[model samples]
Target: MAERPVTDRGEVGGASAAHASRGDAARRLWARPAIAVAAIYIAARLVTTVFVAVGAAISNSRTGGAETIGSLLMRWDGQWYWVVGVEGYPSELPLDAAGNVTQNAWAFLPVYPAITRAVSFLFAGQYPIAAIAVAVVAGYGASLALYHLLRERIDRSAALWAVAFFAAGPLAALFQMGYAESLFLLWLHLALLVLVRRRFGWLYLLIPLMGYTRPGILAFALLLALYGICRWFRRRVDPLPAVQIVHIVLLGLLAAAVGFSWPLIAGVVTGDPSAYMETELSWRRGWTGDHGGFVPFEGFIQASAIWFRVWGMPEAWGYVALGILVVALIALLVFEPHVRRLGVEIRLWSAIYLIYLLLVFFPQSSIFRLLMPLSPLYGALALPRSRAWRIGVLAVGLLGQWWWIDQMLVQGTTFWQIP
Candidate 1:
């Protein structure tokens, strides 16, 4: 007898138990509830294009830009991609221009244009609506991802409902826009889901692409990378019970990196990173808080009305809308305390996401559509437990979402033009 195997039952049992858990996890899909099949069940959420039209009406009614009459959705950054992809950027500036946007061509260089170009080529420009169409696809694709990711811990039924919430939020309107918010969210969530699984090598490669995708994603990518590395090292001693401290420190640095990246990069290229900062601060377009410091808590409070309310007043409502959205998010998170594995799973991931959204509020529009990716976490927290209530609330939220987008996408008198 080969030296009577000396395997300790505790260690052997631990390995055996781990395998058993994975096997159980695999079966979760078959045993999953009906709600988890959210993507298939709630195909009505695909009316995103219809809602996009609604948002255009609301946005246009408030804005009076040149494109407002024909198709109001084609304002600000929207015009950039259309004109650039449809008609490339101008290489030369008019005589008195001194390098200001003498023409409407320059906004296309970011990731949005590249996606648009590919789409237009594939469609043969038979429809200049390439960007918006891509957005529609991205929105649904992200929704599908959310369902699969959440179905693991929550009942399948609730997971499906969460998909409903995501598809039906103002986030859908943001997704419909010619902007890159939808694409960015899709990328961020997929990357994060990967992170949750402890796959670091892939996480590093994805961060830079994310960085290039939107302005601050690079910082987000970097911060996540740092955390994953530290966690890996700490794994030698077992998951750090005190690791939360290190996380907080990393988060602070992440905020700093994101805040400074725009100006810092510009400064290096233009021999003055503050060039970007000057554009934002010299003008009164963004947050009124101290330009050099972080966005204060009070600033967020002031912007509370942006998410749900009309926030008709520009300065006051801007801050007020964001504040309200923040509150709503926190409330939802708290209500679903059971979802964090019923308190077993700490709320750190969602918290980090919430904080990231708050920090970026100073620059983005007051509503903070950036929190869209964080919704799956909230949805995960609320599922299968309530079942009926969960689906009902999500239905209302999703319907209201379309209405919101519809209302936003209107004619000149309805939308606001930033000074």
Candidate 2:
């Protein structure tokens, strides 16, 4: 046999060695704590899907509807979002016999729908599946953001626990569904991460779109304002750099505009500046009256009143529980050392959003779902030194998610459980 050329053999051996080294490096990267956390998160979601699907199957058995795994993931508000994705928002809000803007597509924000529509175009106009896919993808991004954000403040193991806890939270089922929560969370966590990392300049881009994604732009803007003021004070900027101040002011204005974009469009189309408010309040018009003013503890009062009447409990008990719950929330925000231990970003987000929730939200069975955005905060509670404690928290979260799916999604139609 002809002797192989020495140069050719050497080159071939060197190439094989380099390929093996690269493969080894890749394996090392895959074994990193962050990657492991992501794997756990994904595994938890797969388990959550199974639980929700089984619950839906049982629900179909009892209720006798053609509910499938896919349909089960796209119930209630999912359907509304799909409508906006397939058929753009109605130019004229649907009006009731009394001329009040009845509940319509306007109640659902447009960003998620707009995204779904864009994706649907790629999929030959199959929107429902597209909508679910968007939610699922956004949710995973949100989880990674949360993990990365937590890692900035806590040890890797604890941060992993926090992400896992979030994935197993009571409303985790919604993360994989066709709803806006996942997308909203992706932006919200990302914004917090940027804030924690002291990248204020990026807010010019993030805040505006964040505003468009949900109705809580003012809360985030206020947080930014507070941060900017603190930064100025820390630096003792006696005259305040004109450029820095102007940038902060512009960020606020941009946030306001983007956050209120849909409402502004609605107002212009309907020739009613308050059209968005009117549409939002239409759902509560029956009992909430004309004005959409914030009332402290009003949601709890509304919920307590409902429970008192429906469950035949003493009205006093509802008030007592409400008081306890409110106090607990306040303590968590104001006094809990664990809260202070959180990154300033998460701490501020929790305190501000909880205030917004208590003031504006009318509590009901659906209140749990509404509070889903705050799931990131609970990750702190999941940070226990004891392995058993960590496992216990995760178990409770998993069970809560299953129960939510069972009661709210499956048995909800006949019962009073809200989706």
TM-score of each: 0.63, 0.85
What are the runs in model 1 whose C-alpha is more than 4 Å off? Answer: 1-42, 52-76, 83-109, 125-128, 218-265, 268-272, 281-336, 342-346, 363-365, 411-419
Candidate 2 lDDT by residue in tens digits, 102-209: 778877777888998899887788888888888878888888888888878777778778888887778888877888888988888888888777666888777766
Write one digit per residue (lDDT tens) for candidate 1, span 51-111: 5555555555566433332254444456666765666544432222243212233322356
Model 1 earns a TM-score of: 0.63
Q: Evaluated with lDDT, which candidate comes out highest?
A: 2
